[model samples]
Target chain A: MTRITSMKPVGERAIRIGFEERISEETNRYIAALCKAIEEQVHPAVTEWVPAYASLTVYYKPETSGFDEMKSFLESCVKDVHDLEGEGGRVIGIPVLYGGEGGPDLSELASHHGMDEEEVIRLHSEGDYLVYMLGFNPGFPYLGGLSDKLHTPRRDNPRQNVPAGSVGIAGEQTGIYPLASPGGWQLIGRTPARLFDPEQPDAFLLRAGDRLRFRPVDEKEYDDLCSRVENGEQIVEVEEGEHAH
Target chain B: MSFTVEKPGLLTTVQDRGRQGYQQFGLSPAGAMDEYALQMANVLVGNERNEAVLEVTMMGPVLKAEKDMVIAFAGGNLQPAIDDEEVATWKSYHVRGGSKISFGRPVNGARLYLSVRGGIEIPEVMGSRSTYLKAGLGGFEGRELRKGDRIEVGEGAGSSEVHAGRRVASEHIPSYEKEITVRAVPGPQEDYFEKEALEQFFSEVFEVSHQSDRMGYRLQGEEPLKHKNGADILSDATAFGSVQVPGDGQPIILMADRQTTGGYTKIATVIGVDLWKVAQLPPGGKIRFKKTDVHEAQRLWQEQEDILVQVASYGRS
Candidate 1:
C-alpha cells in the first residue's frame, strides 16, 4: 500500500493529498491510480480531481462538503487504494524534424554534451518517454525517461515565443510546446503532429500514462505531415502497449 | 433576445459559474471571477444562477439591444448608462429595441457582470459557457467579445412585464474598495516556507502589480519571503486562490484561469468566500492577508451560499 504522507486543506473548497515529496513513475502511477479510485468512488461534493507528479488535489463544493467532511472521505478513500499500477495506455508515435531552424538549440545542445547532432537525435528518438502528466499548457505532457547524457538545464533567458510542436528538454524531463508561448527549455527538434486541437473530435492528442516514441523525419516528410494535419487527417499512429500494470 | 456589440471594450467574455469536471486533463476551470456578483445578476434577471453572463473587465462594451429585454448589472461599478442617461447598478433595467447601452468610466472595481433576462445562448463546451482564453474554447467562438458580434439570449420566462426597479439591498451588494482584506487558510505547503517569512507575508501590505491578470495577481511589496529550503517543490495540482511564491519571493494568487498545476511553493490559499474581493481589486490596489482556519473559511462560504439561496426567492412570491 502506498503511504500518504500528508493530507491538508488547500483553500476552503479543496483538499490536497500528498503521497510523496519525490517524483517517480511509481509514485506518479500511485497518484494516477488514487485519482482513478477517487473518481470511481464519486462523492457529489467533489467537483474535480487534478493529479500531478506526486500529489492529487480534490476540488469540492464547500457549500455541500466542509473541509473536515472532505478530508475524512479522502482519508478513507486513500486507505482503500492499495496498488500503484497504471493501466497501460496507448503508445503514440511522433514524427520529428530534427537539427534545423525548427530546433534552434540542437547544435548547441549536441556540443554541450560532447556529442554530434546525429548522435543526439538518435539517442533522443530511441528513448521511450512515459507521459507522467499533462499540465503547464493545454495538452502539454510532462514526459519522463530522457537519457541522462542529454540532460541540459533550461535556458537562462527563455525564448519569447517557442513555436507549437517544438520538442524541448529541461533538467531531466522532455516535453513539447503545444502553443506558441514563452518558455525556457532547450529546443532540440520539432514534431509535425499537433498535440492540442480543440477542433479535433478527441480534443487533446495525448493522455497521462501513455508511452510516446519519437521517429526522425526529413524536411519533405515534415511538410507533408503538416499539410495532412491541416487537412484534418490523423497521420500519427497509435498501437496497443504491453499490458495494464 | 439578441444584442449587437457596437463597441467591444477592453475584455468582455461570456462566463457562468465555471467549467467543472475537466481539471484532471489539465483544463483550468475558467469562469466568472466574481461568481457572487454573477449569481446576483442572474437572480435579478430571473435566470438560473449558473447562466452565462457578460463579464466586462477594466472597461465596458457598447451594445445595442436588438429587442426589448430586462437586464441587470452587478459587480464592479462601471457607471452604466442607457442612451447617455445614467442607470443605477444592482437593479433591473428595461432596454427597448435599438436602445444603446454603454458603460462610461469605471467608478469602482475592475470587473462588471451584465445579465440579460435570459442567459447568453452560446454553445456549451465541456459543460460550461465560460471562456478559457488560453485554449480558445467555450464562450462566443471561444474568444472575447469583438465588434459586430451578435449574441443570442435564452427564452427567460417570456414575460412582457419587465422586473424593473427591483434592487438588491445595499448591504447585500459588496462595495469595491481600493484597499481590501482577504482571508486565507494556511496552505498544504505552509510548512515549506520559513516561519519568519510566513509572519512577514501576513503582516505586510502588498500592492497588486501591473502584471496581474485573470490568471493570477502578482503582488509587490516588502522583502521576498524566503522558503524553508528552496522555492522549488514537486509539481502539484493548484487551486484557485492558491498563493504561490516563486523564486523572487513575491506571492502570486492563482485565479479563475490559472494553470492546473505549478511547481512553486504555495504558502497559503485565499478562502473562496473572499475571492470576490481579490477579483475586484484593480491594478495598484492594496491588499493584506489575514490568516484564518479552514472551519472559519467554510463558515464564510456557507454564509454566502445561504444569502444567495435567499436571493433566489426574488420574484417568486
Candidate 2:
C-alpha cells in the first residue's frame, strides 16, 4: 500500500499532501493516481492542482470551501484512491543540435567525463528521462534520467541570459530552458521544440507525468525544425509508453 | 471610454483577480498583488471584481482621459490628483473628458490600483488580463503600460449612478504600515528545518530585501534558517503565499508572479487574508510572523471577505 504521511494546509486556500521525503516512481504514481481521482471527483473550489516529485499541492477558493470542509473532502477522496497503478505518461522525442553555438559546453562536459562529445550525445539521447515536474520557469521540465558519467556542476557564476530551447545539465538532472532567462545550468545542446506557447490549446509542451527522449540532430536539421516550430508546425513525435508504477 | 498614457510610471500594468486553471502548466497566477484594494476599487466604480485595473507601483502614471469616466483609486496612497486638484482615495470620482490625472510619490504602501468603470478593455489571454511579465503573455501588449499607450475602456462599464462620495468604510480599509505582523500557517516542509532554526524564524524580525518585487518578497534578517538535511529539497509545487527559504537562509514569500514550483524548503505560508498586507509592504519594511492554524486563517479570510461584501453592497445602495 502506498502511504500518505500527511495532508497539511499550505495556507488558507492551498493544501499540501505529502507522501515521503525522497523522490521515487511509487510516490510519483501515487500523486498521479490521487490527482486523477481528485479530477474525477471534482472539488468545486479547487482552482489548480500541482503534482510534483513527492507531493501534490491543491489550490482552492476560500469563499467556496473553508479549511475544515476541504480537509475532510480530501481525506475522503484519498481513501477512495485505491489503484496504485499510475497512468503511463506519453513519450515525446526532443530533437537537438549538439555542439558548437547550440552546445557551447558540450566539449567541456565531455572532457570532464573522459568521453568524446559524440559519446556524450549518444548517452544523453539514448536514455529515457521522466518528467518529474515542470517548474523553475514556465514550461521548464525537471527530468529525472541522466547518465552518471555526464554529471556536471552548474556554472559558478550563472549566465545573465540563457537562450530559449537550450538543453543543459546540472548535477544528476537534465532540462531544457523554456524561455530565455538567467540560469546556471551547463549548456550541452539546444532543442528547437517550443516548450511553451500560450496560443496552443495546451500551453505547455510537457506535463508532470510524461516520458521524454532526446534525438540528436545536425545544425541544418535544427534550423529546419526551428523554422517549422516557429511556423506552428508540430514536428516532434509523441507515442505511448509503459505505466509509471 | 478611453485614456492615453502621458507619462508611464515605473511599473504600471493591467491586472485583475488573476488567471486560473493554468498553474499546472507552469504558469503563475499573475494579477493584482493587492487583491483587497483591487476588489474595492472595482466595486466602488460599479465594475466586477475581476475587471482589469491599472496597478501602479511607487510612482504613478500620468493619464489623460479621452472621455468622461467614473474611476476609483485604492491600496497605497500615491497622492492622486486631477489637474493638480487632490482626489481622495477609496472613493469614486466622476471625471470629465480631457481631465488630466497624475500621481505624486507614494505616501504609503508599495502598490496602488486605479480602476475605471467598465474596466480596462484589454483582450484576455489564457482567461486573464493580468500581465505575466516573465512570459510576456497577457495584459496591455504583454507588458507594462508605456508612454503614449492608448487604453480603451469597456463600454457601459460604469453604472448610471455617479458613485461620487462613496468610500469604503474606515474599518474595512487596511492601513499600510512600515511594521506589520503577518500571520502564517506552518509548512508543507516545516519539519525539514531544525528545531532551533524554527525558533529563530518565529522570533526574528525580518526586513524585506531591496530586490523584493511582485514575484516574491525576499527577506534579510538573522542567520538564515538552517535545514537539518541542507536547504535542498526535491523541487515541489509552491503556493502563492509559500515562504521559501533558500540556501542563503533568507525567506522569500512567493507572490502573484511566483514560479509554479520551487526547490527550496518552505517553512511557512502566509495566510491568504494577509497576503494583501504583505503586498502593500514596501521593500525595507519590517515583518514579524505569528503562527496560526489553517482553521484560524480561513476564519480570518472569511471575515475579511464578508466585510468586503458588505462594503460592495454599499455601492449598490
Candidate 3:
C-alpha cells in the first residue's frame, strides 16, 4: 500500500494528499491508482482531482462537503487501494527534428556537457519517459526519466515566446511547450504533433501516468508530419499496453 | 436576442462560476473574480446562478440592446448610464432595443457584473463559458469583448417582465471599500513558513499593487513576510484565494485566472465567503487578513447561501 504521508486542507473547499516526496515511476503509479480509485468512489462533492509529481489535490464543493469528511474518505481510500497501475498506460511516440533553428539551444547544450550534438540527439530520443502530470500550461506534460547526461539548467533569460511544440529540458526534467508561451527551458527540438485543442473533448494529448518516447526524424519527415498535423491528422504513433524498454 | 458591443472597454469577458474538472489538464478555472456579485447579478435577472455573465473590468463596455430585454448590472458603481441617464446598480431594468448601455469613470470597484435576462449564449469549452484568456479558451470567440462584436443570448425562462423590477436588497449588496478585511483558512502549506512570518502576515496591512491582474494580486506591506528559508516549494495545485509568498517575501493572492499550480510557499487561502471583497479591490486598495475559525467560515458561507436562496424574494418584497 502507498502511504499517504499527509492530507491537509488547501482551503475550505479542497484537500491536498501528499505521498513520498521523491519523484519516481513507483510513486507516480500509486498516485495514478489512488486517483483512479477516488474517481470510481465518486463522492458527489468531489469536483476535480489534480495529480502532480507526488501529491494529488481533491477539489470539492465546500457547500456540500467539509475537509474532515473528505480527509477521512481519502484516508480510507489509501488503505484499501493496493494496485500500482503505472507503466501500462498508452505510450505515445513524439517525432522530433533535432539540431537546427527549431532547436535553438542544441549546440550550446551539447558543448555544456562536452559532447557532440549527435550524441545529445541520440540520448534524448532513446529516453523512455513517464508523464508525471500536466499542469504548467494546458496539456503541457511534466515528463520524467530524461538521461542525467542531458540535464541542463534553464536559461538565465527565457525566450519571450518559445513557439508551440518546442521540446526543451530544464534541470532533471524535459517538457514540450504545448502552447506558445514565455518559458525558461533550454530548447533542443520541436515537434509538429498537436498536444492541445480546446475545441475537442479529448483536448489533452497526454495525461498523468501515460508513457512517452521520442524518435528522431530528418527534415523531410518533420515537414511531412508538420503538414499532416496542420491538415488535422493525428500523426504521432500511439501504442497500447506496457511500455517496452 | 443579441447585444452589440458598441465599444469594448479595457477588459470585458464572459464568465460563469468557473471551468471545473479540468485543472489537471493545466487549464485554469477562469471565472468571475467576484463570485458573489456574479451570483447576485444572475439571480436578479432570473437566470440560473451559474449562467455566463459579463465581467467588466477597470473600463466598461458600451452595449446596445438588440431587443427589449431585462438586464441587471451589479457590483461596483462604474457610473453606468442608459440612454445618457444614469441608472442605479443592483436593480434590473427593462431596456429597449435601441437603448445604449454605457459606463464612465470607475467610481468604486475594479469589476462589475452585467447579466441580461438570458445568459450570454457562448459555447462551453470544458463545460464552462468562463474566459481563460491565456489559453484563448472559452467565452465569446475565445477572447475578450471587442468593438463591433455581437453576442447572442442563451435560452432561459423567457419571462423578462417580472425580473425587470427585481432588485437586490441593500443589506445584501456588498460595499466596495477602500480597505477590506478578508478571512482565510490557514493553509495546505502553512507549516512551510516560520512562526513569526505567519504572525506577521496577519498583522501587516498590505496594499494591492497596480501589477495585479485576474491571475493574482501582488500585495506590498511595510515588512515582507519572513520565510523559513528560501521560498521555493514543490510545484502543486493552487486555489483561487491562495496567498503565495515568493522569494521576494511579498504575498500574491491567486485570483480567478491563476495557473493550475504554483511553486511558491502559500501561507493561507482566503475563505470562499470573503473572496468577493478581494475581487472588488482595485489597484491601490488596502487589505488585511485574519485567521478564521473553520466553523465560522462555514456559518458565513451558509448565511450567504441562505440570502442567495431568497434572491428572487428580495425582488418581490
The candidate, 2 or 3, that scores higher on lDDT is 2
TM-score of chain B of each: 0.98, 0.98, 0.96
What tens digits encode model 2's per-residue C-alpha lDDT throughout A69-146?
888988888887875654688889999999899889999989988999999999999999988878777888888888
Candidate 2, residues B1-317, lDDT tens digits: the string is 79999999899999998898877768888999999999999988877777899999999999999988888999999999988898878888888889999999889988889999888998999999999999897999999999999999998644454675578778877888999999899998899899988888888999998999989999998787888887888878888789999888889999999998888899999988888889999988999998899889988888988987877777767
Which candidate wins on DockQ?
2
What residue runs in model 2 are displaced by over 4 Å at the alpha carbon? A84-86, A241-245, B158-161
Question: For model 2, what is the C-alpha lDDT against the true structure?
Answer: 0.88
Q: Which pairs of residues collide in candidate 3?
A: none
Categorize the docking of model 3. medium
Per-residue alpha-carbon lDDT of candidate 3 for residues A154-223, written as tens digits (9 for 90 to 100)? 9999999999999999999899999999989999999998899875558889888888999999999999
- Choose 1 or 3, whichever is better by lDDT: 1
**TM value for model 3:** 0.96
Model 1 chain A is weakest, by summed lDDT over 10 consecutive residues, at: A80-89
Fnat, 2 decimals, each candidate: 0.82, 0.84, 0.60
Q: TM-score ranking from best to worst?
A: 2, 3, 1
B273: Cα error in model 2, Å: 1.7
Ranking by DockQ: 2, 1, 3
